[model samples]
Target: MSKPRKPKGRPVSGWLVLDKPFDFGSTEAVSKVKWLYKAQKAGHAGTLDPLASGMLPIALGDATKTVPYVMDGRKIYEFTVAWGEERNTDDLEGEPTQTSDKRPAEEDIRALLPKYTGVIEQVPPQFSAIKIAGERAYDMAREGETVEIPAREVEIHRLTLLKAETDQAHFEVECGKGTYVRSLARDMGRDLGCFGHIAGLRRTLVAPFGEERLVPLEKLVALEEIEDVEERLAALDAFLIPPVEALTSLPHVRISDDQVRRLRAGNPVILRGRDAPLPTPEAYATSISGELVAIGAVEEGEFRPKRVFG
Candidate 1:
């Protein structure tokens, strides 16, 4: 009888969500996973601070192309602010800038939370990745220079005070990309007629992925013992949506073998099968089987593929 053959490890393509471990920098986490998997290429969609732990998506192989879409998704966080205090780093990591002799009441803080809803001005903490003079703002701060990071507009979709105490209040917020929680806490203190700083911060979700899907560092570290690692990967379609077409406006067009060849060759095709108004610039192009094949737009009577995936 022939001996049974052991399964050979194969290359993979997908996104992996790791519940980032506290104290592990985003770069370190990526490196660890890359080394463990012996993957040739890996990258993260968005970076989470070493101090902040939560949903972090790591893209493997061809899935790296979808990272930008994933990173642009809405983000949600649960954090706490220490009223009557301000910090340089805006979080517990920095030295106190100022401390108030009094704390704001819970109701007062709750009332002010709504003020942050919608658009707002946010001056990112000097100790941040923001760039100034071609160097990182945080690096300038570390060199003992007072870096002035200009205020930029960021939107806050929702801000709710989850709980409150005398000196601190818990909060849950849903905000757009680039909105900083540390900056919000700092500003919240100022709103309360006192200084404030972020104390406890946790990112619960980066839309499409939630806390329920996060795998903590402890669990990730133990993954070495587990045989299957595919559970953490996000499907390719998770961030992609098929193009919208109305039956009244246009019907599904089947791409013939010749057209498929043309599409593969990056040729512009006059889709006669397009019975209705083809697709808008935002429409997703897919195969006849409904598999996302490319994103394209109609121009000069030809459908040009903005992005193609065979």
Candidate 2:
């Protein structure tokens, strides 16, 4: 019989809320973190553009399993919309596709805010990750192909105008997943009789993770200078937030050792006691010692394991 191939690197597990710097791509950030930690597995909850800087939640090892939860959470962004010119990419990176001499007044921009709030249809930018016929939109855009992109619904929980300049306006927004700030800038300019594109963008929060948890990329790089290998790795590991932290939004239950064993074995465990939680669509079980055991559903007084964790 052939032997099973063992995975490489350390089995480090946790979430690293990275304060990603401008011009740093999300995939690049994940690769940098993985190389620094030498972890066996790593993934990010969401993609942050190279032009944007802010909270990027990265999962190491077992924490990768919980990425979908973080991705589904709301996001908050502070952005600058520069008027008078709209680019194809919807940001400064692309050439201007349309231009106008007019700039919107503060009162006019404020009046436009309500129109963008709540559930509204939005069209993504040409230079977006959205796929068309199994190919990336950005790929087609780079090759000079202009394809008709469809509009879809996105929720903008709140949109606030912070400051307005002669040719630019600063704003903050809290929105649901898949919402595009660049498109907001583009559409708003069109409605205001001025063309616009994103001049700057910085994410302040991703639901469940805020600026408080952000660890700068520079800090992690500094630790690499430690003389001893173990000490360097320990310094890096200290920045990791527990994987359970990512599951705070979900219903949770602490189980006995017996229940933990059964959950790890992919078996259902019966709920006990008067305080046991009511049936839930999704919940997570932790060992008596407070370590995550599995993500499961509680139905008919029993917890059925879905994804077990070590």
Candidate 3:
């Protein structure tokens, strides 16, 4: 008997902002999406813990180049802190290492908000993906190794006490890259004298994409179940957000076809447009038809191609 043919994956390119479900790791989520789309290449902007559920932006093909932009973008998360217990992982996933009977009042919780706001020094959780001397901290931690994580500066644009119950408190934080909500909860508990760990977490927004564009895993799985490959591919494309959308944060300049060809050929070209004399150091160069040609820097009014895209 002849063996069935393996799928010759499609050259899919675009972004899929997945509403990652609880108990699913970011890598698993990416693999599921990539299989559903039958994409040749795939990657995720950032990771969401298996205990956390929220936006996990998966990039395919050319979109992978913009993963850094989305990862560096401001992020918004709503998480719940379960007061009275501290765990090894700083979240409910680990065993309880410490406990407290004290719980702070609403006003007490509110008063502490200011201290967590703005730039703050935070030590990442030992059970984190952070690399320590070429080894993953979490891997080392699980093997019973002592992990000493140094505190690093992280920006917290906003940290508010949304609601406080007797045993749990909800919070919403808008922060820059490197801020760990787990660490935030740990420190908050320490300050409140109650001890706490994250009970739940959800990411609502990652710049250029949010809840509005989030596609749940179930929908992608449904598409994957379809028997016809062509029909499946067509249906999946309907949900793709153009990879170029990731470049939305950067300045953009529309260039003529001749300039597009030159830029794609790795040549610098002088641009003529309203946003000319390119104020931003780097900008997305689009063609007359709005197709992305290259990512380049503005030098004396000339757009020098640094990374050209087809």
Q: Candidate 2 or 3, higher TM-score? A: 2
Which pairs in model 3 have colliding backbones? none
Residues 1-310, candidate 1: write the lDDT tens digits: 9999744433455556777877789999988766665566678878787788787877765556556666777899889888887989998889988888888887787678768999988999888999998999999999999998899999899998888888888999999888899999888888788898888878888766666766666755654664555543222224312222111122233455566667667776676543534555533445576544545566555666655555
TM-score of every model versus the real structure: 0.81, 0.98, 0.95
> Stretches of candidate 3 above 4 Å error?
1-8
Q: Sort every candidate by lDDT, greatest first.
A: 2, 3, 1
Model 2 TM-score, all chains together:
0.98
Candidate 3 residue lDDT tens string, 1-310: 9999765787888999999999999999998888888898899988899999989899987788788889999999999999999999999889998999999999989999999999999999999999999999999999999898889999999998888899999999999998899999999999999999999999999987978999988888887778888898999988989888999988888899988888888999986767685456788888888887888788887889888877
lDDT of 2: 0.94
**lDDT against the true structure, each candidate:** 0.72, 0.94, 0.90
Q: Top model by TM-score, which number?
A: 2
What's the CA error at residue 158 for candidate 2, in Å?
0.6
Better of 1 and 2 by TM-score: 2
